[model samples]
Target: MVTKTSADVVIVGTGVVGVVIAEQMLDAGHSVLMIEAGPRVSRAEVVENWRNSPLGVKGDTSVAYPSRPWAPHPMGGEKPEDAYLQFSGPDAYDQTFIRYAGGSTWHWAGTSWRLTPEDMRINSLYGVGRDWAFDYETLEPYYVRTEHKLGICGPADRTQQWPQTGTRSAPYPMPALPFSPGEVKFTEVVKTLGYNNIPVAQARNSGMPYDGRPACCGNNNCVPVCPVAAKYDAETALHRLEKKGATLLVDSVVYKVETSAQNKIEAVHFYDQHKQSHRISGKLFVLACNGLENPKLLLMSTDDRNPNGIANSSDQVGRNMMDHPARSFTVTTKEPFWSGIGPVVNSGIMETSQGSFRSEHAGAYFRYNNFARNRFVTFAALKKGLVGKALDEEIRRMTACTADIVAAHEILADPNNRLTLSDKKDWLGLPKPSIHYDVGDYVRKCWEVYSQPIGKQIAEAMGATDIKISPKFNNSKHIMGGTIMGKDASNSVVDVDCRAHDHENLFIPGGGAMAAGACGNSTITMVALALKAGDAMVDQMRGA
Candidate 1:
């Protein structure tokens, strides 16, 4: 056991949120300490791991970056009990997240979509879900800050923006990447149905470089790992943060948060890789862990002062869980639409996500998945036991003709869709996270009444020879709404700035604080919230 020197701020989980906050604190001349539950590995190592992995495991996003037993996270195809996250629900919340120094962004597709103003006020306008404590206008500047920080590339034209109705304070940091042949075809075909496939804002360097990273080489392996450092992952900022004088402790799993008088966070207790416990006190604490992990950590840190858990007086720490429940349509187009030319996701039908029909059912955003089809088609050809030239021909034909359209529907926050501490324990004897999820009728209505009908139209318009829609909904893995934010303290875990209502010095930002799960990737919003909380932390440290 050891007691380390105190810092002005201590943040748990060195994901994008934690890194953003640490950088902000350093800029403000505040001493910062960041603790991560996973080991630090080089990009080359991850790329090599992906290369050496078997073809069957290549699709599993977490396969390349192996997990440490002490700090377990959900792997691709682990058994129910063996999995880090246990589940008991109609829908399986089998999310994939890495407990690494850079966090899950390492395996993400880097889609950065901003939520429209209507997205934040869904409850008031559509009579569904909880409205954000603040409006989109209040968070717009922070959105710009996050976009610039991440070097987001998007179209300069307002018409090509994800939500045409939303206003922007400034244009994206970089111009949008050109659509691949498949994406261009998808965009044109969808247009025949009065649907617009707008370019998606993404956190990747374009032709010109802004950040230290180079421009995208278009390898099309953005999911497992980008071979080149073109995409903006949290790991890309780690070196910059260390240069800024912020202390980052990798493999330091924070298990408990100690609170002092007035329910203020005094220090956090963590275990290193050796399982040796250590304590580091700080003026303020930020838990930027993902949606599932944040709630589990709070629930595990109960004490005499906090009978339920620290900063969980509202009993909403692990409740009101939400995510984008998605259904996919796979079709073989009449003409060859070669994918795998650029990023895995470049353009999407975002306009479909908004409409007055949202009052009756959740709206959905449709994306033409741009993943290379060779690997997928190869497996299918082998399953048929085709030999030599026959297999090669089948593989090539399937790769050229196949396409996938994903319909990610917005889901409302439901207390029943919850995350709780599990009875099962991990290698470190820590309680695992257990989840209960049901996409609910709102999303179901979208699939049956809204998304499926439009999907049929898209397939028919594309002159598809064969089409198949997935029967069940799958998670987009955009977890949100555990430590939900609101104006009232009783019903919410955090305030507008992501500060805990029960603890003044404690901040719980990121996806956990998102009040609504809009039909888009939630990383940008999470990072924006971190920036918002960062400003609040600076103000508090300055005695504002």
Candidate 2:
């Protein structure tokens, strides 16, 4: 095997979490080497691929980046027979993450949200899921740093801002983007029902450019691929890291993380595109490879001392898998709302996400989906055998009046919903990730008792004629809680600083290190955790 000993810090996964840490490490004058499993593709190539894709697969964001033979990820449209993740539970844990240079941020919705104090202390306050090792106050500064780094845009008004409890230390870098006509009308209609629809804080430019990237031009293609660099994808940070003198290895699938007799990570071994093995040594190693892959890599790297896994002393490396279990409904309104003008999702209902009721049932966040309905409506119209003027009229009517609302509920940490290495192997002969997931009764009750009723009321208040709610629960793709953090090392994989409890030199900072999956999007929180971990890593290296 080829060996290289050049990096001070080695990070697995070139996603946002990994790149964020790399940026901090490189800024502190430490040499960083990032290993990415997937191939690198330019923005032009991804946009061209999206444009050439079939209309049926346009909504599937993963269609822009097809999975490679060696480093596979979940695909949209027609799923391959030999998919990587094997799901065995009531609900399918079909996560859609690209194992590429920029990672899954390529198709992210760009929604940036900070967790409320209550969200972090659910176990202490509500006696539900496990509380974070530290409070939100400790992580607030990191949240501000993340917002500035990502160039987030949001409302400056205290009432309109999320949490609305004076948690923000600084105003958003940019003002909130103007709401689309559909969002404005939905806000007005929801007000009649005493429900507030607030503008979502998103990682996109509002009016003026802040970072090296340009302002958002409202192409309404935030998902799949943003043609312009307005959205904050890891590729932007990866470029910054490269310019700051960091090494990036693409198409390098890290299969094993080697540990010394002292239980500290020595090097990580990866397979190149040619399936040739190579090892890279570093002073500090980080596994930012998302929730699933991080634990899978650890479990796969079993040695004589740690027979279970590298950091599986507590047997919690791949336990307590959680995600935002969601349900959606479609409604046809009497008045035209015109949802095709701006970003796909501009606003959401956040007030419902926290309450004393969470102790009894799960709390949920609601989004007014603003995706253009022309493609979906046209397909329906054609299937109905409409000809000429009738088809055109139907399409226009449906496009103008249809509204799709989705409610994503917060799931408590359940150790039973876990990720394990499957007996089935991939093309590279590595074991595929096997997940057994159940949305749990809390989320199920939230859908039946709380979210469903509120959703019906909002639809009716908006003059909806026909409202159809989905019966089954679906995943929101916000993966969390695989490698959870807690004060006790026996029940947790990482500590308050996101450093692995078993290995001091190894850090696992991402959604995988999250203790609680709050109702809102978890990307911002993940970034905050990474920032905190980066600071700790810098200090540790300095002390060494």
Candidate 3:
């Protein structure tokens, strides 16, 4: 028999957005019960597994990810595996996510960028895309709060957008991390060209410790698992909240959000690890599931009351489906390289984010970062033939010579790029989400115009020879909207406060509700919006 527990709120995910919301709600005097399909990940286990395993991959889970409990889900400092999610046909690349606590942040690159102002209002400014029901001003405060929570480090880039993103706020919990040799060289060239080469806006504390987390040791194994908890994972916040008396149910997948005939939420029914069923009811229902999973649950819970989906009377639960299309290339040059800072502090340009440039379609500035291949093993992994310090020096020279540049992501506004319920279902017979997305023409243009010039400049500065193309593309991990926000309910999912227009007690937060897709690495914005959503829910609770 399965055990049942109850709280004022039952959060369906333990990812960053859900975790943060839970923490905020608990702090606000709300009893929250978070349901996560993955079990609690022990940091020590992750370190030991990575250290003992081949290729530094975590060996805990056999399904796909080694460190992560879920596949196609990404997190910070981890590399994404193309083999994780396999899709066939012309409409494949649409479905991608890590179904675990902290979600895909386990394998994320640790870059925490806030969305530009234009991202909030693509429809109002241009005749393209859809207008956000709420504007950037509403989200700016929450963004500041999230920055404080995650220990972000970066100088304010006023020229980019939203100059007042808290230039006067408390200093970053930690000082900025150092730039690698390749990035420093690129910085010089960019300065010579009269452009602002910005340091990465990261979630890890490097120069000093903040919020009780340890400073990054530049383990270089930022992906897979960090023996040291340098990167911010949602688990940290979730565990803290749980300690504060919030409840978290592990290995439980919420099957459907069962509601009453009066259009009021009755309870959420889920399957426990033992495959037993239980229901947990609350005054309000918050679906903190990701962009894909949120819609899937709603659609599955259809009844005579809601034939389409719960809170999806507008049939806008799984539409829009926006994600950044990144174009990355590697260039190498002979600049003397030294440093263990290969993890997240690599620097690059941000000159294009602001000011108007007319193209056939909407376009904005891009971001650049230094990336290089990691080769060689720890000193302990050295074979009998190569044990000397001199041998180590030679290995570093080859692997550290190359640099990576990740540029502006083009946002394609197509209703066709969206999520849909698959006739196929999971082990529990719940409809699994399938995404259908095709890169837009604007994405192609941004790639062609920027790649060669940026690569040639960086390679020349780094003194690298034979710059080449790396086939790895952005796997569409920044799952934005199927549930978008707009002026009209006919075209969007939620309203200004993220309240489902059809249901008063239901709310959806994070990138899943984003009206517009942003530049690469948009976690900060998600965190902010989640906080905003939590506040809105709290207000509603008080009104009741």
Candidate 4:
């Protein structure tokens, strides 16, 4: 049987962005309803799933939250899987995003970074990429709010932070987590090369408990699932919103958005697990369905008045797809520096992410990956035909001596690298997303000119004996720029507030609204934009 519902606000995709918006709306005493395409599972279930996973799927984060047939997510195995995203370009867009109740935050490393004032004005300063519609100053307060909401722990000293400009409005909720022996060693070695390795601001707890979650014990399983809930995830906010009177519907996939003759979003139609249809009407509609899925939904909602899709008046709904494409290398060091302690990633080199070099090529942020290498090293040891104590000794040696470093480069906004509805369909008969991706000459030049040299230098600084650099670029999973924001509507899908220019009551928040994909992880910026959009939506609802 079909059903119908009404609310003051309707949000699709119960990810961190959607939950943040819902929390704000609920706090403002507005009736909120959220739709999630995937099923809801508990933290214990996810942790157990990871624990029981096969050897090949153990480290693969997406396997922790199994995808439903109706809602498919990209998965990576020994060989990269392209079952969900159809790649059509030189480079593959093998993005891993869980469609579960809490969305992709289930697998994030919890790094919360704020873009510098200069990062928002790349076009004006660096002569490449489109500038954000507004400056960082306008977004600073919201960044603070997001940090406080997520209970981020970072260094109080501004010098230990990126940018080092003292742009913070408030101190971090907790003090920074102490670095591991490997991080200390890496930092010491890099300093000899005049490189600064600063602590990354993370959403996980440090010392004291916060927001009903315990302090992080540094289990080193930040990815796949944070078992103790020490790290912030969308599920925390979702539960908070639910307690504040927000209605959440799981296994409900929003398929079409309906707009009135006045160009105001009146209702959205969704299909449940059983393929039963339902209509949800609201005064305001927000699509927090990530970069790729958000644009796909908008393009799918074609009507008589909107033949080119609901928000495709400018033909830019699914254009300008971007991400922080990474190139990584592994090096065997001289001495043992055990890396399996603390978080998966705790610190990075942010100095190279800025400079005049960005005008010609992209800038990059480098990191010493701290993921436990037991699984990786064991596989290598077995492949070497070692047995018994020899294999054990080799595993221990490889685990402690091998250092994996990754350099993630910023990519300029190129409309040619896009996400379009594919001719193929999914289990529910909806068109799958097909991506045409090219890392562009800007990023390629960055790898050749800046990233490779710096990476080799860092390896040498650590006294590496054997080094192997990846031949091709890889996706960082920080998807951005499908429904990009701009002041103008001609070439953009949304305005500064993430409001669709074609529909007054429609808002698309999250990474899809990002104008430029910076070098660092973009989750914090996405949440900030969502908070800003929440404020806008509140103003509209209050008639202010």
Best model per lDDT:
1
Q: Lowest-lDDT window of 10 residues in candidate 2? A: 1-10
- Tens-digit per-residue lDDT, 59-172, candidate 4: 688778888877887766523333878888899987889888888898899998788888889999999999999998899999889989988889999888765653777888
Q: TM-score for every candidate vs. truth?
A: 0.98, 0.98, 0.86, 0.98
Stretches of candidate 3 off by over 4 Å are 1-3, 56-96, 156-173, 337-342, 358-372, 376-394
lDDT of 2 by residue, 501-524 (tens): 999899999998889988898899
Give me the overall lDDT of model 2.
0.88
Q: After superposition, how far is residue 165 of candidate 3 from its true place, in Å?
A: 9.0
Q: Arrange candidates by TM-score, highest first: which order?
A: 1, 2, 4, 3
- Provide the global lDDT of candidate 4 against the true structure: 0.89
What overall lDDT goes with each candidate model? Answer: 0.90, 0.88, 0.64, 0.89
Please give the lDDT score at residue 219 for candidate 3: 72
Compared with the true structure, what per-residue lDDT tens digits does model 1 show for residues 1-544? 1124578899998899999999999999998888899899999999999999888778888879889988888887778878898988899887888989898899889999999999999999999888999888998999999999999999998888866665698989899999998888888998989999988899989998768899998999999788887999999999998888888888888899999967899999998888999998999899987788899999999999998998899999899888899999899887888888999999888888888888999999999999998877788888989899988888888999998899999999888888999999998889999999899999999899999999989998988999988989998988898899988999999999999999999999999899997899999999999999999999999999
Worst 10 residues of 3 by lDDT: 67-76
